[model samples]
Target: MTKELETKGAAIQGADAGKYELSEEQKAHQQERILKQVAKELQLPLTKVKASVSLLDEGNTIPFIARYRKEMTGELDETQLRDIEERLQYLRNLEDRKLEVIRLIDEQGKLTDELRVAIEQAVKLQEVEDLYRPYRQKRKTRASVAKERGLEPLAIWIMTQPRQGSLEQEAAKYMDEDKQVHTSEDAVQGAMDIIAENLADDAKIRAWVRKYTQDQGIIATEAKDSEQESVYEMYYSYQEPVRKLPPHRTLAINRGEREEVLKVRLEVPAERIHDYIAKQIVKGESIVKSTLLLVIEDAYKRLIAPSIEREVRGELTEKAEEHAIRIFAENLRNLLLQAPIKGQVVLGVDPAFRTGCKLAIVDETGKMLYIDVVYPTPPNNKVAEAEAKVKAAIEKYGVQLIVIGNGTASRETEQFIADLIAKLKGRGLRYLIVNEAGASVYSASKLAQEEFPKLDVAERSAISIARRLQDPLAELVKIEPKAIGVGQYQHDVAQKHLDESLKAVVESAVNHVGVDLNTASPSLLSYVSGINGTIAKNIVKYREENGKFKDRKQLQKVPRLGAKTFEQCVGFMRISEGVSPLDNTPIHPESYEVVDRLFRELRLELDQLGSKGLKDKLQHADAEALATKLNVGVPTLRDILDSLQKPGRDPREELPLPIFRTDVLQIEDLTPGMQLQGTVRNVIDFGAFVDIGIKNDGLVHISQLSDTFVKHPMDVVSVGDTVTAWVLNVDLKKGRVGLTMKNPNKKQ
Candidate 1:
């Protein structure tokens, strides 16, 4: 409340009442309300959510709180904590906006008790905005003009309708030639305008109208040019209820509308909405009934309907974008967490027609040992020379795995590699097709240039491809997440939102898998829980200056890495081949004492971790009992025990490795009923695209995903999954292959 309002309210109440104050009470109530609301929304206990929010407020990263403060959060996963964190910020902002709205209204001397209370009680920003809409300043609106012409009294009298006499005469009393109210009819029209504006600005009325439209509205689309054929053909004559419209369809319609290929509109029931507004505003029959009816109709048609339609469309787009972002984030997580084909000397092949096939041989540690170009495809199809060059490079590097970029000329290059493998005797060489969706983007990036300034873009891309196979998380972190291409409709969604979500997914994946402290690049380290790009670079620079990180504790010595940063990051940065075995595990250093005590109780040395003796001893140990003895929470203690069993474990190790083959299959080789094992390249709303040792990845539609009904393709498959699928149809002309996970012989 403003100082003037506070004084006036105090004087109105009593001399002893003093200045009216509710700030402290309001703050406390809002904070408590936010806690309970977040708890109810997330379906977690209030205490656990409160604790998690407090921890979040205290600067704990989501990964750290989830991993170390499990007892406090009741073992809430990173996803839950992140949701709470986001909601916490939202509710806090809501409170701030409410106060600001109150102050703005108070400044105008229009903040009544009921209005202030409504603003304070509003839970969502939309509700607060609705309450503020009436008081918001207008620019020479019809209502404002009516008020200027002194017709507000006439409008108010019509609303009351106490007597049924001479409505025109009453309106004529307000008419003035000087103000452009030349006739009683003009006077009545101005009054009706006032009533229309009032009805339109009524917050409750607008809210109800919006809800009703969204619940019952139908979204209809028609092709701008019916005869034209386009990808949006399916939606050219589409109609779906607003409530039931799926996210993909919403995005498709939006894209079609943006491209001017489809005309779309929300089909609202006009008669029903008009009746609703009449019921809310109109009273008993009177002389002014027809006049008020005109106002209500004009209000609904001219003022409320258009504004509410925009809001409804915005709400739909917001929800659709959210769903799309969720799918993108989930798909990105799976792709980033894919199993790294570790310990392989791999050769990366970037295929092109005119530029030749770029080749780079990377050793097991991802160090580029050789870079060359092989012209294995037209127009300079040097098949034998390309074969000899690859053979020599493979022989010299002892390359066990070859990663071919699935881009232009990939099929011809694959055939060349397959033929070369056949000609070469007993080297046990195998090749895997790697998704090169963002390789060119990465190669042309500044970071890539800095990393490999001496090499051409294609050569650098080849090196990145090989490194991607070796350590997917490490190499993928170097590229922009959206550019990695594991998402659908990425370009259509809001870029800032998509970027934030993808970055969070990468952070979660990196923290979950943990990074090797000594060998991890700044790019990989930047995704660590509490580390930024600057600090990541500082850590790497420190490593280069001092030596390998002797232990995780040495991370503190890096410039700008403070105690909190170390606390949040150390557990996720493993130091294998370090001073202590616990340093190599996911166990935080704060719990090192607990691990030591457990080891002592088990009569085991730290070096004996992962040994048969340690495994046998811990195999039958009760986590609750051990937790009590170690003075730690059961979840953390259990995690400690699990980590002890598999020191230096990479969680990605358990995921399916990439599909490797000695030979490749042409698109023509695929036939119906032919079963082939393939890697799921990308999972989208409609289907999964799988790479089956061919140039074009085949699509496994959601209907053929299972014998049972599948709600989504992701429910049955994820990116990087290896599954056995049978060919459904092969279109050689279109270079398209359709596949199914179901049995080919099974009847539909």
Candidate 2:
């Protein structure tokens, strides 16, 4: 390692001590590379990718840029923008790591022109690491010891595979007692160690070996204790090819292994790997070929095999985690965007046993009208007494719908409510069971406490249940998106990735539905395009100190809300009684002038928006020609038209309402081929879990999702989807039910 070998790159690295600071020109070059690569991979135009990247770099939020900058991004949606954002971040990180790795290699006097170019041109971080492996500084190892004993030259000489060399004499030349080389055999072994490490660290060799192992390996699992029964009994003696293993099974096997209930192994094709290594390291019948063959075997067994197995396993886990995060994100988006049962007075029941069921009545606007507790199950089954209080509250609060929390004692409470509604006969009342997955988490949250300090946890939960029936997105936003429990293997996946994906899903949904600025809580407001938690709280504080915001422009007066924040968030904040009706619409303030001009061009009053006259004109308006006349792009003009047509509209309202039931069913009552309607509570990679008025949600396996082959469960169904499913089987003792979405009577 000579200091004089240091070059210009090394000098720069030394100046900053490996700070990874790229100059302006370097950053620009890197960004251009990243944008071009993202565009190619995503199949988007390079110009569009560049425009979107520039917007993102300028601090424009994904939701804002997606909704408002369609002209610039060629109509890219939120999903595309987020994909671009993720790619840019990963490539930037890769570029930074490459610079750092290059500096480290150059400092060690090992950086060559080919290696430097390889590192710079690498697209993935793993590739950079692989290229740097041979030059990387090492801890104590057999190879390091061999190098210390001056055996590297002999190793290199043997690698040349000389046709006429004396193996014994060559090995004897390295015999020295001072540095642990005492005999010809010891010298031979030291040279073999050096050669083995060299082969193992070669980038191309490792890459080829890793791919071969991953393609041909089989994942095998067996019981750690065979006699112990477990949910993973099917995996007791299971083996599946790595290429054929599904993501959900991967997560399940990983979890079982983690819990020590199963022993797992990767059964790789050892003979093929050995042959390939021999082919690479050995030539036709050289003098050192026999000794080098032994070196290959030792290297693979001691170094390469284990490393390749771990890399394949890590790759499997990373892919599985990514798949799980995607599933969770899609499910969460659908769950959060479930159609709200608006304009209905709701009675919420939080069922329990000895502690009693908590009841809360909310008006059509989601304001709490009443709250109390009644025991209708088990130890404190106050059937008639509970019915009277519920009936009286229904009458006093004009409750039209009842929402029961699907939690402890839910079935018993549901039966009680069914009987009570039966006694009422034609009272125009109905009850629906709602998934209360995060009600407990929300009840104990600080936001819940601040909203209802005088109420107990269960009471707060009841209110949440009632309010969610009114507006799922608004009420559910108060809880963490992951806690909503719409995901499969959420706890087993990479937590940071899942959290980031779910956060983006929530933000996308919140902006899509548009929040009522005057009424949205800090949680919902924080998810709006540019608002953070602090700004959200400040907006609320400002509202409380002054009053309901009567105009959109008043948002500028709030502390910490500047021009950028206002620009990003204002379009998604709606006010029902704002100074301008456009404030209640999604129309951005910047487009107000064009809209007024549009109204003038149509010869319609501003109040005529959403009226028949505006609809008639919009139906006849030529978007392309009108946009040219209006000096605006067609996409922007079309968006303006859509927003004007549906002022203060919720995108969720267009979806089918959740299935409401006035009765309950038990697992014992489910019979094979018996058809029933249900709502999909969660979708996983394997299938969808449907709520069919039973204690446990029925599982519709992937095979039964459709008659045709289904690629994934999400392609067939999502969270909050309504479908007709037939009961396939029921395990009475285990309280499990299986369902099929295929019709039994349909002919093949």
Candidate 3:
């Protein structure tokens, strides 16, 4: 399997060259295979897969189909829709290739009924290639040269396994000086070469060997330079069964090998493979048995082993990369959806030392109210002066939250802010450390500069910090998704695959929360369903020139946003202060007739959509019968009912609120078994990094994630999760703290 994953970590293998070559009739047949494979793999209904695939092929975006066309897909969510799309592409490519290969083989006059059946039934690209191995065009190997010398007949004759004939003497009949067969020995050797190559190309044997290798192989590594002082020291003398190696370890070994820090190889029981091949090809005892035995040894060691090893290694790396990218995508989605500390004036501080901490104060609406710099840390150590400036801004803007970036000198700045806030203890102010992973990158980005042309990089970062506290999804969209640094070995994975998955995650989050049509930035608008970057820019321009949008229909007037784009994106774009209250809800324009009917038939008015009277009526309504009566899908009607209850609701509010701090704690304050609350900063395959009001985040290893069996850290925690963890170990020298989520009070 090629295992080329992109969005949603597609397990789509093979180059889809045949997708363009397939005829409509061929594609129609391929559709059945695709649907069945997808349904079986995802355990979704086959009918649902067919409908989802049809919607996808008609150019509908995933978020659009997931939200608006729920009935057609049996209420499959975005994730299920994307998976069907992934498998559909893979199976279509597989079918198209099967047809293309059949055409290629038939054109060469080698097609047969058995071969056709084998090709058609092949489930994976690897199987198809194996079946096509012998017929595939060759690069002048020993077999090809043997055919040139008329030794193929001799090789074919040897296959009958003459019970009592001298193999070399039988070969002597074909010896000719013109063909370079100087002796019977030379002719026999050439015949054996042909037999060896043919044995290596046998599809059935190749499949068996591939499976046996993986089941019995050991992946071993050793240091290339013993004294290199590398981070892969643990892998210096490592040995793991190929079947049991985890994704992270596989990626690590690949990186180590790439950096030339280690020499890695797969160790398998070669004798067993040789014996297996001998049994499959040698047949009964005969004069040719000894020669065929030699052929098996040559075919395996010289041809099959090397190629299988490379394929297995590629598969391992691909699987690992897919897992890592998925982790990154999930973490990023959770990070973006982090509950915003809304309705409060926030003071954002981009912590620094010599350059001074940059400060930005944003109001409840995220409008920048003030920007300044302070030098309360190191070098100048102007503590009192910095404190006065911050105090003036806080008192002037009535700031309720102090958001400090966890960067250089962040600990010192937090201490200073803690001291200052403590002095005004009754002001009802709180402070918290914000992850600054992508702040610097976003600050220097072209988008940031365009958004705030007058501000310097650090000053812009301060504003971003403040805005992130106000609304993470809106502010985070300004930066590239992968730059957020949420996963392990992100840089080592396939860059294109990682980019596609992360972008999808961002889109999913943006749509889930819904976008405000009037006040959204161009950066945020670009991720809304069908809106491209160009169309997003056009939207912002139109809004700036014409003022706020009164209705969602006004989006049609924007340049380059045609009817199709509008249809795909309108439901995700909400107008909170629009002329029509229906526009504020997720109810699609096409569903307006249904909503009007729901209200009219239920003896309700549009103004009373979310009122307790209507909500109660909706709560007890027969949704199934009502959906049929309204001529809409039950899922869509339910969604409309939901949207009507709480129009323009920000879904982030439902999640647990972010943890705020009133004081700072140094590493010295942590003790073993001390329970503390913290926010999960980043989650990887093995553990989660949590910010517990300290400089470095503490780690909750998968082992300590729970008292019961725990598989992955993500299963227990995600980024922005508020968890209570007990300190297990604190190493002041290394500035590391180990934590466990298991309650110490629970009896084992």
Better of 1 and 2 by TM-score: 2
Clashes of each: 0, 0, 0
Give, for candidate 2, the lowest lDDT window spanning 10 residues: 1-10
Q: Where does model 3 exceed 4 Å of error?
A: 2-27, 138-154, 165-190
Best by TM-score: 2
* Candidate 1 lDDT by residue in tens digits, 1-748: 1111222222123343233334688658878998998888888899999999889988988988989899998999999998998777777667666766776677688999999889888877778888988888889999899999999999899999655689988988987899999999999999999999999989999989999999999999999999999999998888999999988888999999999999998899888988888888678788887887788889988999889988888888878888888988998899989998878899999999998999999888999899999898999999989888888888888989888888989888888888888887698888888888888998999999989999989999999999989898899898899999888899998887789889999999999999999999888999898999999999989999999887888888899999999999999988878888789999999999998899898788987888988888888789998888878899998998899888888988999887889887888888899999999988888889998988778999999899999999888899889999999999998899999999867777
> Which 10-residue window in model 3 sums to the lowest lDDT?
4-13
Which pairs clash inside model 1?
A: none
Report the candidate with higher lDDT, 1 versus 2: 2
TM-score of 3: 0.93
lDDT of 2: 0.89
Per-residue alpha-carbon lDDT of model 3 for 329-418, expressed as tens digits? 999999999887778999999999999999999989999999999999999799999989999989999999989998899999999999
Model 2: what TM-score? 0.96
In order, what lDDT does every prediction score?
0.87, 0.89, 0.88
Cα TM-score per model:
0.95, 0.96, 0.93
